[model samples]
Target: MTFFQILAVVLTATAFFAYLNYRFLRLPMVIGVMVLALATSLIVIGLDGFGLSLADGAARLIAEIDFDDTLLHAMLGPLLFAGALFVNLDDLLAQKWTILLFATVGVALSILLVGLMLFHLAGALGLDIPWTWCLVFGALISPTDPIAVLGILRKLGVSKRLETKFTGESLFNDGVGVVAFLILLEIVAGGDAGAIHVASLFVVEVGGGVALGLVLGLAVYWLLKRVDNYQVEILLSLALITGGYAVSEMLHLSAPIFAVVSGLLIGNVGRRYAMSEHSREHLDTFWELVDETLNALLFVLIGVEVLVLNYPTGALPLGVSAIVVVLLARFVGIGFLVGLLRARRRFSPHSVTILTWGGLRGGISVALALSLPPNPWRDYLVTITYIVVSFSIIAQGLTIGPLIARANADSSNPTSD
Candidate 1:
């Protein structure tokens, strides 16, 4: 399919599935669209058993879409910026220490734990996957997708403090996770970089992204302050997303991090100080629409992507087991940090449980897995990544609402605690 044809098909599917979700399914729009798309893919696969060519055709089209490039290069900056824009800057600052630790150290810890566990599991199951590749999976899967987390949190209306932690961590860890994934992937491909060199590269990418975002954000803020016209200001914001991300990419920095940081600055500082009331409202509405539309398309693409993945002989068991392993690693990795933080400060009841389950994976993980160079282990990793992401979005995403409610109830009821 040509690029335009592919766009038409995806847009049509997204619109139809979105209407169905709103009309009957009544689930969160992102999750509902994905569920419907996934169902359609499954039906196609089932029909393929009877000599139908629908599955093959669908797979061909999906393969042409270049999921990683479409997502990472094309969609991610706007989505990340939008997600960060509405966050309460004050609340985020209040939890700055928590977010920093979890986004950095916590992500590293989760990667290590997940890699080691999966390595042992693969060996026991007679799989020959190497440890480096397992770590790559770990790196990709460790961070929560802000797009998924923010959408659900808005509906659930969790406590401000807790929501900030989730929002802040999700927004920041994505860049960290991507950086880690690249480093590990290089190692897996026989790169000969030494430890100090690796550390310097990591610092440059992550820290430099944040620095670049600050510079871009402040420059935009100055521009917004001088302009009374909302349209121009909004266009400037768009430029920040496109130009800033492109610049980051060219400089080999973390574009995802750059997006989030600039977004937070504009959303909070610029919104408060630079823009008129009219401009603020218009800007928010514009970005919100962008966020919703892009998110719907992303989830739908994820749903249909299953048609293209090659499931290996033990894929079912390995993928299923991966779900458990990821959950366990999340608990062990971040739970310890939450526990230590609790000693120094108060945390909500069952904070670990909330954080673990609330860390929903989305397109980012799948994109990273799909970006892997073809190797013997690629299919299995991608298959399991899809399974884990599916369960995270569909199962964990749906139930986290109730979990938050119950936690709130327990918090309010002193007797329960």
Candidate 2:
């Protein structure tokens, strides 16, 4: 199929499912689209079982599009930028320590815990996954997807403080998580880089990306400061996102990190000092639409992707066990961060639980899993990642509304450290 043909099919599917969701399912738009697509995929599979060729055709169509390249190289930069663009700079700064801990140390902790648990779990299940590959899974799944988390949180009307923490951590941790994933992937590829070398690579990728974003952001801010035309300003912002991301990739820097930093700068600094009222409104509307459209399509793609994944027969139990492992690892990671922060600041009751359950994995995890090199365990990893992401987005996502409500009620009586 041609690119436009594929695009047409995806958009058509997205729209149909979205309407179905709006009319009957009443689930969150992204989640609803995914659920419907997944159902359609299963139907296709069942038809194939009865000697129809629909499943093969569906899988072939999905396989025509490279999931990893589309997401990691193209969609992710803009998506991350859009999410970061709306974050309130002041609120994010206020929660800097908490965000930092969660995005950095907290992510590392989750990776470690999840990797260890999965390694042992695989052994118990007689799966032949190596410890390193288990860590690869950890790296991919550790970060809460900013797109998924922000989308759900926007609908929940949660506390600004809690919302900020969730949004801020997700935006930043996504970049950090990708960096961790790359590093682990390198080790798995038998790269002979030492500990110090790996540390240096991290600094260069992360630090260089931040530096590049700051430069691009300030340059755009300078231009926007002198302009009053909302159209031109909007165009300039587009250039900043697309050009900045492309340049970061060319320079071998972290495109995700660069996008986030640039987004924060533009969303906060540019909005305040650079853009006029008219310009700000237009820019916000444009990016919000972009975020929504991309998110819907991405989730639909994720759901349909199951059609292409090779799910081994004996891997079902391991995949199910992985879901529990991921949730427990999330709880432990968030609990530790919240507990430590409680030393210096009070937190709402059940903050840990809310954060844990609210950490919805989405397309990024799927993309990372898809990007894995050809290995004995690649298919198994992909299967496990898809199952975990589906549950995280659907099951945990559907239930988080009540968790947020409970957290809000408990916030009034926050316990002091």
Candidate 3:
């Protein structure tokens, strides 16, 4: 399919499902679109079973678009930038210690625990995935997608404090997670690097990305300070995202990290001092629309991409088991961090539970899984990732609102924490 044809189909499907969601489902827009698309995909599969060949054509269309390349290279910068743009910098700063801990140490802990547990589980289930590959899955899935988490939290009415924690951790951890994934991928691909070498690479990728982002952000902020026109400022913002991300990739740095840092700077500093009121309003509205539209299309693609996966029946149990394993790993990771923080600072009641359950895996996880180098274990990993991400986004995502409500209730009770 031509790019225009593909874009037309995606936009048409997104609009139809979004309307369906608005009119009837009334679920979160991204989740609703995904559910509808998944149902459509299943129907295609069923039709294929009946020898209709519809599934084949659908799969071909899906294959025509490279999911990993499209998301990681093209979509991610805008998505991350939009999410970070509107974040309250004051709230983020207030929660800096906790956010830093969760984004770095907590992510590391989750990766290790998930990797170990998945490795053992696969062995017990008669699967032959190596520990390293399991670690790759761990690295990919550990980071709660900022795009998904922030979107859901926007509608859930969670406490500002808790929402800050969720959003802040998600914003940074995905970059950290991607760095870890690349490191593990190297090891899996027989890089034969020692611990010191791997650690050095991590430092370079992460540190370089951060430095580049700060420079880009400050430069853009300076330029915006001299501009009064909303049109000009908006164009600058676009250039910041596209140009900054491209430079990060060329420098072999973490593009997501660059996006997050630059976004934070632009959304906060630029909006505060650089942009006129009119410009600020226009910028905010523009990014909000970008975030929403991209989210709709991304989730729809995620759901439809299921048609292209090869799900061996034998891996069904492994996929189911992976869901539990991921949740447990999240529980352990969040529980440990919350416990340690509680001694020094109080958290909202059930913060651990809320954080664990709210740790959503979305397009980022699927993209990473799909990007895995082709191997005997790749299909299994992708299947398990799809199951876990689908359940995470659809099930846990749907229920997180109530969980937040309960947490709020618990916080209001004097007898509770």
Q: Highest lDDT, which number?
A: 1
> What does the lDDT read for residue 312 in candidate 1?
93
Instruction: Give one digit per residue, the lDDT tens place, for model 1 in 1-417.
Output: 689999999999999999999999999889999999999999999997889879988898898999999999999999999989999888888888899999999999999999999999999899978988899999999989755555566676666777788888989999999999999988887885699978999999989999999999999999999998989999999999999999999999999999999999999999999999999999999999999999999999999999998889987799999999999999897778987787776776678888899889999999999999999999999999999999999999888888877776777731121
All candidates' lDDT scores? 0.90, 0.89, 0.89
lDDT by residue (375-406, candidate 2, tens digit) is 89999999999999999998998888876766
In terms of TM-score, how similar is model 3 to the real structure? 0.96
Clashing pairs in 2: none
Clashes of each: 0, 0, 0
Candidate 3's residue-wise lDDT over 325-352, tens digit each? 9999989988998889898877766777
Worst 10 residues of 1 by lDDT: 408-417
97 in model 3: Cα distance from truth in Å?
Answer: 1.1
Which residue window of length 10 is worst by lDDT in model 3? 408-417
Question: After best superposition, candidate 3 residue 185: deviation in angstroms?
Answer: 0.6
Alpha carbon deviation, residue 188, candidate 1 (Å): 1.6
